[model samples]
Target: MANSVFGITDENGNFTIELPSWLHATPNLEKACAVKVIQLPLDSVCRLRHGPSSSHGIHLSSSEDGFRTYTTGWIQLQQHDTK
Candidate 1:
């Protein structure tokens, strides 16, 4: 399957996550999934610790075919401050 996760960063430095294909295959699809988004400060070591963290991103995990699949998407930081 070509399940994928996408992330979009807004002008305010916030992020929006796009559901995977498998999760939205049906009109009333309900599958277990996990999403994580972390905002890193500019020029911070936190990014290194997190392996090049993005200003906006998403992490997704779902069960499929007796196995779990994970996907991620990274978005560049916006100029405007969201906080």
Candidate 2:
């Protein structure tokens, strides 16, 4: 099981990573089943921290006529850095 990474678009059209519901069910995500979306400065580096066996991923979707549509792909989280 591996954690994944994902990106979301901000008001200014810039992209940021988030760990939404989709990521929770990932193979190794149970450890960090709860997730939060945090916003930072536009030029700052973003970081994701998780415990052992925790995973992160993202999904993109849209709703129309009471139905939801999703994109086909997801980002992958390969490793963690403890600094």
Highest-TM-score candidate:
1
Off by over 4 Å in 1: 25-31, 35-48, 52-83
Q: Rate the local accuracy (lDDT) of all candidates.
A: 0.45, 0.44
Q: Which tens-of-lDDT digit does each residue in 1-83 have in candidate 2? A: 25545466566534544555675455643344433334434554543343334434334356588443343343222333448
lDDT of 1 by residue, 33-53 (tens): 433444456653433333343
TM-score of each: 0.27, 0.19
Candidate 2 pairs with clashing backbones: 3-77, 4-56, 4-77
Number of clashing residue pairs, candidate 2: 3
lDDT minimum window of 10 residues, candidate 2: 71-80
